[model samples]
Target: MQLPDPSSTRHPGPAPYLRIATEEAFAPPEMLEIYRRILSGANVDPGFRGLMGFYMSSPSERAQHIMRCLTDMDALRLKHMDDCGVDMQVLALTSPGVQVMDKATAVSFARIANDYLADAIRRHPTRFAGMIAVAPQDPQAAAKEIERGVSQLGMNAVVINSHTQGEYLSDTKFWDIFAAAEAHDAPIYLHPNSLPPGMYEPFMEAGLDGAIYGFGVETGLHALRIITAGVFDRFPKLRLILGHMGEALPFWAYRLDYMHRATVKSQRYDSVKPLRRQPSDYLRENVYITNSGVAWEPAIKFSQDFLGADRVLYAMDYPYQHAVDEVIALDGMTMSPEHKKRFFQTNAETVFKIPPR
Candidate 1:
């Protein structure tokens, strides 16, 4: 499908618009070598092996560009943001980061990345905001970093990619991460990653492992688990940011509530009692979503209508979507001007408590 060039469609003659993007990503220099080691490791699973091959299949010039984009914060990144008409970005570590590492490696590297991001934000206060990268594998350390990131480093949000090894955030052991977020009122931006081998073996070589099928299914399931596991009840203030337009959950929303009620009411569920609230309630109240990698207008409209526009924010899913003349494409969407304002700007500010520019 053909689309308009975002450059041509961007806000004409920029009157200093405050477009605070909630989900553009970057990988720190310290974490880059760690990933190279992981990727080059011999024991990497077959499904992941295929996904890595797909990304690296890009010609040499593009691969070089991807590496530079992953580490650079000042020159090319800022220039692209300017070109795309993005006034500010809430930057995060790209996927398969600390989640794949052993606890010691994950802990030390999480600090390094978070510190890099914190320093970057300090240097360019107006241009960037940072999300803390905590290693979920170690809950105490993760909680400590959350406090350090928020109170000490001036970071505003937290990001944990969907799973660590095979464990989801819904597991009780990870509740400290949730508690940290609620205590500080920091939103946890749960990004997607490739599925683990056990769950992904069926789609082994069909190219269904990463972003296409695996990310949405695994992330959506993770979100549902958080809801059904009574996570919201424990920490009502804990808010989550789900990317890729709620990972296709908004469309099937009502059915989730209905079906969940039907099964639980019928004693099909093993738990003695059903959830105090319907699943949809948790999604609406505790979750916020970003139109990052997926920018389809219909999906954006549905997310706004279903989840409330206040809970939806704009992002470019950078480096991946980094030709961000593509970022301006969101300007072409046919929403009310008011909705557009909230989508691109205010919602992010209010949600992240970003001080005015």
Candidate 2:
């Protein structure tokens, strides 16, 4: 909650890099209604529903303020960006966004939500960018939305907040989205949602499912699912972005490769098919990781070195982890100006095809 002054980290001379936060978030009120209804009706544990119910209700001032932040794109947010020196924001829908809704609502509401974001970005192209929200509940419609969101609306990236219900992205049911994203050359941002229904029972009491630990586990598994399930093989040119430093995956890159080669080759899981490249290779080549809500420099350093600095990006994870101190810390990374430029600005330009600013 305490925000540091952005001016504290600046050098006496000009700024070193232009910061473009890739995981900036916003949620339309209409989308919130859909999530409330879906969560209430979902066949999950009762306790988890209770927690979601409380979260949906603004029980405390902090909760209320957070909700306000999600919907407001006024001068306050821009001031925060200016205070933190963030040049542009790739605004994606918040977690569980339309991902939890029923087919009809998800389809209709996602369009409305994305259209609002597009209009907002159009009003301020220099400071803000848009990311498409596609509801996987209906894959065909979702694919079309991807096409429209990219070509028609000029949104830079596609964002799906982790799984839909219990089904992950690797399932063949969602291939149309993968194909559309690849064709359009827009990277899909694989954000973290809460743990799928059944799994949340264990963590609901302590609230681990909402990003303390479960989000990383669930999202890391989702990315791994895509890699192992041949999603990348099917759409080799498709690119994916992961927040929280690849949801804690890059640190174990070698272990994943070693284990996959030793075990997958020897005793192939029925679920995992053959991959043209190893899991680590797909991660290095096709995946871009962002340091969102993850201020630890060691993780960023390791991710840049291991995944290649070209594959690493900067993000503030706004409204949730929007601490000014995090930005100051990231600006102080011990790397060359070129690597910092790539992390802050160039990687986003190349990935999102953002026009000259």
Candidate 3:
């Protein structure tokens, strides 16, 4: 059951770049308990019920292995990072986070999780940086927590596991969270979760309701929702970090800009509003993406070329899809050393405001 010790397999001597994994995940034990409780309760999203039901009690070895990695914030996690040549992991509270809880519970759990993350960062300042977890169930409270996380707890950013109870951030009720993020200059990392109810059935029937396809579909849709809703225009200073390569947005630049313009012009969808810039312009201007699960050079390079080299950063998607060969593959990408440094190191620093090592 032991994960491979990649230290012996890593390339010898000093690496030319630092690997700051931006989409890495960790969860406090209490959060997992919340998930367990939700499984037996009503009003739970079916997809979440399925996903956690499997993870919590599945006899599958992979599930157990991932559980160990997800719950560990100290020695085991650090050992995995060292083994894989990851210099640092920008830790985030894992998917669904406090978003799955009721308002009161969500708010309280967020505070607890934020403090836990703050402690982890303090314990290993160089090896770890964190994104604040907040419950979007209560946007005002979420905003307050973001302020506290950034100004007081030293969190690098905020992590929202997309869609709170099937409600996307595009809703104006959630704008307070955006306002807080903008004021603090803290980037919001939009991580993925299982599809919500109403949209979960078809995907689940096909067994695609988890990472294979659903996560990207759900999160990409959420990102586009925010873009077309004019959240970026309203909060121009806000920066959004999307892992899995901008949730495939960079790849669809021409289509998004064209369709968005067409939709707005035709007034086909009354919800589509006029934007100050093209949909893709916002991607270039206000968004940064991480190459998390994707290790393919062509996709990574295309995202960089399309979004500008500065916009794409490196990530290991640790404990979930962390593989030594992925790191080697990214290391071998066809790019200048300067670009590589930015890909693996500087871009994360610039986006997350990580201090120089």
Candidate 4:
């Protein structure tokens, strides 16, 4: 999988409207050090060991370049955005961000990272918007941090890097985080992390534990778990943003609805609880999907058609999987000017509450 070089293509100048790229990621410098320390310690997550171990230690040009881009919230990132004609980027702390740390470390680092991002946004108000990073390791403290982020820091959304340790957000222990998100009306961007242990070893053995195929599998499962667990029924107003084309959920909507109904009716598993609506209903009504790392026109169009036009948005998946040519490809996608506007700009504005430029 060769990545596009932003330097290879000429900028297309301006577009019909502001181009806001959601799902962009940045890391505080110290976060890298923390990851390094974790990699050297015992009881390391196998998925993290596979993903970050490679990125943090590999000397390949791609690894080095991505590492450089990840820590830079300033010039280099801005340059790529400018070169790609992206008007704004909605930044979130990079994956496994403080999630693998202990409760005390996770809580404290989450606040520090949020403050770091808030300051960056303050400096580049028009260029950057941010999502709140919270530690689900301590849901109560996390809920308070979410409030502080939205109320005091002017952040637009909450970013949960899929799971904590090996636990998904569907568990009741993590509901406080959802409660906070719903109370503030802040969308939770359920970004992918490396797969959790037990389920991750096989994928890692095959070298599929990163973004290639494992991420969608892991994150899509997390989204479905929330739906099947009646999280939506519990907090009907909660909004979720799933990247990588809703982790391929739109394509499987009908199957999910059908199978979920069958499973619930049979009570096959104690956890297979009934819901007020079908699984896909929650997707249509409560979730938003982004074309992050997915540059194909047919897939993007299908996602919009299947999930409703307004529920689809654009994201660069910056630093990790971005290219100027990919931006050009998206620009040339066949859609009505109005729908295109929603896909590239307005949908993100609405979902993330991004202010107009």
TM-score of each: 0.92, 0.92, 0.96, 0.97
Candidate 4 lDDT by residue in tens digits, 1-357: 443455665665668978899999999999999999999999888888888889989999888988999999889999988888999999999998989898999999999999999999999999999999999999999999999999999986999999898898999989999999999999999999989886897887887888999999999999999998999999999999999999999899999988988888888899998789998899999999999998888888898888899999999998898688888878877889999999999998888788776
List residue ranges in candidate 2 displaced over 4 A.
1-14, 38-52
Using TM-score, give the best candidate's number.
4
Model 2: how far residue 27 lies from native, Å:
0.9
Q: For residues 94-187, what per-residue lDDT tens digits would candidate 1 score against the true structure?
A: 8877888889999999999888888888889899988999999999899999999999988878999887888988789999999999999999
Q: What are the lDDT figures for the candidates, one per model?
A: 0.81, 0.83, 0.88, 0.90
The runs of at least 3 residues in candidate 3 whose Cα sits more than 4 Å from the true structure, single-residue gaps closed, are 1-13
Tens digits of per-residue lDDT, candidate 2, 1-357, equal: 343453365432236667888998898877777666666574743533544455678569667767878888868778778877788888999877876666898899899999999888878889888899999999999999999998799986899988897888888888899998999888999998877776776876677767778889889999998998898888999999999999988888889888877776776577755668888898899999998888777888899989998999989888777666677766777889899899989988888888756
In terms of lDDT, model 1 sits at 0.81
Stretch of 10 with least lDDT, candidate 4: 1-10
**Of the pair 2 and 4, which is ahead by TM-score?**
4
Cα displacement (angstroms), candidate 1, residue 80, comes to 1.1
Q: 3 or 4: which has the higher lDDT? A: 4
Over 208-325, each residue of candidate 3 has an lDDT whose tens digit, in order, gives: 8888888998999999999889999899999999989888889899999898888888988889989999999999999999988888788888988888999999998888886786
Model 4 Cα displacement at 5 (Å)? Answer: 8.2
Which is the winner by lDDT between candidate 1 and candidate 3?
Answer: 3
How many clashes in each structure?
A: 0, 0, 0, 0
- Please say which candidate is ahead in lDDT: 1 or 4: 4
Off by over 4 Å in 4: 1-7
